[model samples]
Target: MEKTREWVITGADGLDDLLVDELLALGGSEPRRLKGAIAVQGDLAAGYRFCLWSRLASRVLMPLLTVPSGNPDRMFDDALKYPWEQVLRPGATFVIRSAAAKGVSTHTHFAALRLKDAIVDRFRQRTGDRPSIDTENPDLSLHLFIEAQQLTISLDFSGDSLHKRGYRLAQTDAPLKENLASAMLMQAGWPARGEGRLFDPLCGSGTVLIEAALMWADAAPGLPRIHFGFDGWAGHQAELWKTIRDDAVARRLAGLQRPAPRLVGFDADGEALACAHRNAESAGVSQWITLSQRSIAEWRAPALNSVAACLPAEWAADVTGAGQNYSVPGLVATNPPYGERLGDEGSVRYLYRAIGRQLRETLPCWDAVVLAADITHADALGLEHKHTLRLYNGALPIFARHGRILPAEPELPLAFEGSLDDLPEEGMDFANRLQKNLKVSLKLAQQQDVRCFRLYDADLQEYNIAIDVYEGRLQVQEYAPPKTVDPAKAEARFKLALQIIRKVMGLHRDKVFLKVRERQSGKQQYEKQGKAGKFFEVREGQATLLVNLTDYLDTGLFLDHRPMRLRIAAEAAGKHFLNLFAYTGTVSVHAALGDGIHGGAETTTTVDMSATYLGWADRNLALNGLPDSHHRLIQADVMAWLKDERDLYDLIFVDPPTFSNSKRMDSDFDVQRDHGHLLRLSMSRLAPGGTLYFSNNFRKFVLDEALQAKFDVTDISAETIGFDYERDPKIHRCWRFRHRV
Candidate 1:
């Protein structure tokens, strides 16, 4: 019997226990777990078996010696004491990799350089030949590490981290590492206890399915490798390794004689599926696996009677055990992209919810495991899990857990009523209206050089949604239905309408922002719906405005009032401008910067109640190259500011919400009830022959007859409405009021 050799196997953090189990199963003894590595005693054949069978380990290192190290000088002397010519031939190329804890050897690159110097000097003295360093591919790969002033040197037996697997010739957008996929499969109990079936719905590059196929065929992951780091070492025994590999080949041939496990992969991206086929072919497991192109929502479990119908005729075998009467559902394992790497959190949540519902309805008996980068993302799946296996993929921390797919109970049914394959009636009507409206609005926008406008404004009552286009991005707002409407039906209609809009407009998932518009009271209008704080620039006439689509219910720029801002810009020149209830100060920015305002306005003052809106106004003003000395921002109640103002303005723009009860205000203000008092106070500060453009979004707003009698009032609401918004006459009401001189 051969003597046992001490070995250390290193892998990603948090999978130490799994690595230990893998080593112990391959005839290793006295297996011990370290922080992120494992130590075991095994013979030469045992070591060779681990190098060939390990799927989770990154590298297998054979420690030659340990030396006490302090500074660079001592480390160099210690490295030179080891025999280098024996490990490598006279002219064989080599490379030294280094890692150090925060101590005397702080820099990894400097340590690596010192080790190389010592090895090269020793080789020159012994054989009179200095070995050349090959960074890309080396005959001998040396690993050097220093921790707590102790340095240990080892020879890397399995080069390139052992995770490459050498079969993945192509990659998708964010492909998972092969080893991490294998770890997930092991945690799910694949090929152990007669594992039957395997599936990956979102398989990109087919890493998970390919790894499972290898395990099912009883083939080693490294069987296809033509070279390893130990090939050139003098201590390597060639015949011992050949025996181990020959045994693996014979086991693989024997496993092939029996029925192959049903391994399948599906991806919505056809290119990804094609890549999976190429990868499976390279891995020599193409015959045992099947690939298809379909979305997650479209996936359905195979019928129990014909479970293996999708596979080739020669590979189709009984999906059930010999004594079992029915076929069992396969294990589902997938590594779906997280929010940070793929799309937004909301989209990923929607995807996970769809996946969970599909699993519950179709494959309730199947065991599932999903690997997610975030705990929040995993919770979005809406499935209960037994436990999570925490692991690391490169630098990203991940959670791999067993997911429970419960059967749909008769008492409690799923919320989804219909499939999302096509648009419903309400959605179809909404899409047609948007297409018709966009044709005219787009032409009008191009003629006027406008980059933002309303494309659809609740044309279909059943789908109470408004679609606005800013540049190429779309912002959709769904109006809260009345109490008479069904909540579930309303949600279904809203989702379908959004789908239609996205398809018709060719918008990516991230390009469309959705919000719900409800009757807001108090500070609800100013509250944030999301914290993304994403802003995009849109052009209205000459000035640019920054509008946030994801943060709040209402974007900073109101599309219906685009014409009014342009009108204000056209009329103001060499005049003092006042914008009360300024919101984002879009009109002020236009007035201060537009070319129509010759010599520009002397100075502009913008007043709003919310500090957030005030800050947004400041950014808008700065975006258009407007000087602060020429533009001012004030956080105050518009009514109170009107009372204290002593100076008269040449032009004024007042556009207030329908209702507000802000904490900063002395009392709640209603536009319908307070218009009389608001107009009376605002006209007092108006200069002689000055015009005040008053606009309100209240659909039922009525001008006070008493105030109209006192001031020169012209209902120019018709003139303010642009061609795009003419369909909704009551979108906003505007009037030009001046003191009767």
Candidate 2:
């Protein structure tokens, strides 16, 4: 029998024309763009070529036959009439996938089911056995497209969605699907050859970077992928596929230009940076790219002379590579957070303004491209737009704006004033007066830049102790008595001092409710009821961090751990990470979506003891889109599971509560006493040459001197405390331990 071969490239609706152009570039003949597909007349070799090089197409479909039908029954009958024997063996596994537009059948599933029955019935009638359906994975995949009364059934040549490039072992929140990212880059007019730098400042998961790199290198994005749909198809052409891949490799190797544009990404989150680096390495482009953990405010444009200096070094090291570096000026591009994903509308607006201001101030000469949700926000950039193009990103309308930096605007003034002591004490009662006096003393310490300083009167009528951190130092003090204090008031003041000494140092907030509890009674006295009262109240100049003492047990801020969270978020983008005892999954969420690189197993998995905490993790994941199938959430004891689970993780966070008791685990754990055991268990699950971040809020915690023999621990407690912990910065102790391979 003579066979007819045709190439069909599937793309996002409204992008078939672009796919046609891409197919034509890959040597397809007579390409025609349909409503949702691009058809090209090609031999088997052309099919292979299209698959390897067409970045815009979702997948390449090879048509066996196009049967015409108006209704479900006729569609099924037409499907059965095809020469099934030629396409599949009697006992082979297969699956049918269908898509229906408005004018077509309203129920896509029913249409798909009918087609499935027809295929089975036809095969059954002929050979007394039918091919089995394997939806998860199938030997052969059949694709059906229905529009209006027109139905088109074809063979799925690419198999799975082309975006599953196989390099990703894990995924972070709200990952941009691969095809969508490629489409976005293509739409942005990113040049294949450039000395221009490509920057994704908010490079969550490194999707944009990897996609751009692949395009620049002219490398087939699917080369590293282990499987392709065509490999399992009945009309599979191994020789053609090899030729196509070999040709692509040859082009990539030959087209490898010297002095490729400097590709860099930066984020304020450490976990994001780590993830980006890992992803770039996996993609085989780490050497060509740079990833940094830096706030957007810290980013400075490279000097032209600095770039020229690199040219000489490059020429000395590799003259051939030097020639490749001169293609074009650098380009800075990123998809900043929109209200739907990262923050509320006001916060997102602020973030956008920050982005606009930073780019305008720092990268005056660099070309800029930004993907934003609407024209209004794009206008907020305040840069004269060279061009604006509309595109749909996951159903939301987005405008990709290209422009140069505008004239700089004056910097905004600081929002808060001087330290707590400066607060007025007029009209306060005795206790309030004492509190005001302590606030003033703390302010004085801050002004002096004392790392640790304290102020309190020993004989204050009601309370007499205050602790504060000045310039990162810790200070404690007993308040001196005011003149003429009564004996009863003195006794009360003395009791308050004893309570502070005994209980204040050991206070632990309830993870589930964010409540403060008495260590001895195990009862929560202050509970956080909702978000309204649960914010960390900052009186800015007076103190970097302050809590609403009456509304929530513990302030919404963990001042001491602020620096650590910032560090984790900076390094999070591309690394596979594990966060144990994850309260609210804040660190995990930050790392999964912060920036730098995009897309990889540097996806973070969080495990905690309480389902309540896990539920909070779920909300955090949804809040960030880091909770896809690739992200794992386990409600279990980190210690117990570390022993049982053998899966190795790249980064492990082991911040256990100071103490815990659960009937579920049949044990009560105290971090101060059990940290050694906890650290060991966590280290057991660490990948060779992996890092474990261990921290505890037990102020009096003494490291087990004996555990030093097994692990090398670097105390980072001082470095991890942020300015917010102005009062007693050493709120917790932290260490980074790496297993000696």
Candidate 3:
């Protein structure tokens, strides 16, 4: 027997055990699993066998040497030790691929250059002729792994990834790699469960379907691939390679001559089906597979001929266990889309539920493998999973859940009727509740011609979300639910609510924005919620304010403060106005542009810490035709600005955050803890007979005793709570304070 060399086979993460089993099943021995790579001792023939036969491998590596290498000189000397003439001819082109430990200086790209330079220099010094470098189609491909102060150089036996079998002509946005798709089928017991049907109803570009066809025909994954890294290597065995290739072709032809399995693929996209056909043709498995343009939602399993026709003798009994006499046993495996947006949750859940229903109504007792990013989606299938395999598709962590589709039950209702207004039963209850709430506010909103207001504030206990309308657009903020509730269920309800709101209001998808509201600390409230900087002008009585529904948690204008802004406009005539913590300066804009029923403000000063909001304030003033010269927009901490103010103002509004720990602040500010100091400072700047208005949304706010004694304080929270916000009195709280002269 020829001496064996140590070989490492690498694959995607979460598939190391499978790859190790594959290597051992091949002619490799002493298989040991490392991180994402499996090490095995194998002869050169065994390496070539794995390159051709192993379906789960990403790359096959033959280790040449290991050397201690942290310093640049040590790395160069270690790489130079290899005999360049043996690995490559004088003019042969090569490329190096590298990976390194966390703190290494030259990790991948730079490390490859260093190793290549050493190889080139060694050849130059020995024969005065160096091999050229080729990155695209290198004759010799080298792999280096640098960990701590050690570097291990290996010869790559697989040119490109084994998954790239020269079959994929087109793909969708997130196609599963071919090798991973094969692993999924193996995990589901494909050919081993012989004579059983295979289906991928959501097949995108048909990678999964084509792999299934190959499995049905006993075809090697690499049989169609024309190139391997060992083709031009020094140890190339052309005759032995040709023999192995010939054997694979003979086996494929023999398998195709036998009765093929019922392998079928269905996709709603016509172009995707066409692409799948092209790929299957290129793979030479087109005759073994069938592709169709149809959605899984309308899919029903074909009827079985007799009890004997049911797959795997136990399936008939299992389907009979669900109180159904007839049974169809097969496999349904698919990689469904992982929706990354809140709006996408509804559709994803609907698809999963539809699959579960089709399996129950049509193909009960069948085994299934569903690859989904969120485990909640698998759970949404309304099936009891036998087990789950964790896997990685690119950088995303996904789960391949294997389960038996059970009989339909009321426990997990399939509520996907395909429309927002016609949501499933549970979702309908919430949508109807929103409809009722909208009815209560629609009349009042139309009478006043109000453009923006809160339509729903968690009207139903189960749906923990708030829906607000800004002119024609809608913004939804879902309050983080307690741990007692299932997150997936909560998310599903939120998605359903958004869709219903859009349909009810006839709003475009782009006009709706959804955000998950979590508990905030520090100045996170001022952070930008999204990258869309779109702002639209909405009417508020006589004033026009700019509002952004997509960029932040709170729109530019506070709808609950509509009545309050009107109050300020009534009393701000001929008065010098001061707005503190002036978010967007809506009140100051009203004061500056008052109708002069009494008189308008002589001058207005709007102070806030956010430059973005200050810029917004300037825009609001300009929109309302208020001149910038009379209005001063000061960007500073309200507390710091209050300390420096000596001028007197007739009217002032101080509405600070309930709690603020902004990084720019010298110290944290809590309305309850520091209200006395804040009030005293602002009151000192007020004229003798001037009144101050203070408000906050702190549900449990309490006025300070010292400040109450220092001035005549009147709680006007009841009067300030407007009609639109009358349902929730604590939406905002306001007070009137007159200085004791």
What are the lDDT figures for the candidates, one per model? 0.78, 0.62, 0.77
Please give each candidate's TM-score.
Answer: 0.57, 0.53, 0.54
Superposed on all Cα atoms, model 2 deviates from the true structure by an RMSD in Å of: 12.8
How much is 161 displaced in model 2, in angstroms? Answer: 1.0
Q: Candidate 2 — worst ten consecutive residues by lDDT sum?
A: 311-320
lDDT of 1 by residue, 73-141 (tens): 887887798887778776778998887754443677887898899999998888788899999989889
TM-score of 3: 0.54
Question: What is candidate 3's lDDT per residue for 1-741, written digit by digit as tens?
Answer: 667989999888888777877888888999888767899998877888899988889999888878886666787887888786787755778888888765766646777788889999889889998788888988889888988767888888888899898889887767889888988888878877634477777788899888888887878888878789887588787888888889988998898887867667777567878888888888887876677655442243332322322222333324566545544467888886655421224335444655676667666677788887778878867766777778888888888888777865433211112234455665677767776667767767777666678888886887778888776667788999999889888777777777777766566788788878788767878989898877776767656678887778678888888888888988888799999999989999888766434545878999999887887787676544353446788989889989988999999999999889887776899998888889899999899889899999888888888888879999998888766788898998898999876
- Candidate 2 lDDT score at position 82: 78
Output the better candidate (2/3) by TM-score: 3
Question: Where in model 3 is the C-alpha error above 4 Å?
Answer: 102-105, 300-318, 322-328, 340-347, 410-741
Better of 2 and 3 by lDDT: 3
Give me the candidate number with maximum TM-score. 1
TM-score of 2: 0.53
Clashing pairs for model 3 are: 573-599, 574-600
Q: After superposition, which runs of candidate 2 have C-alpha atoms over 4 Å from their true positions?
A: 1-6, 13-17, 89-91, 103-105, 125-128, 192-196, 254-260, 300-328, 407-741
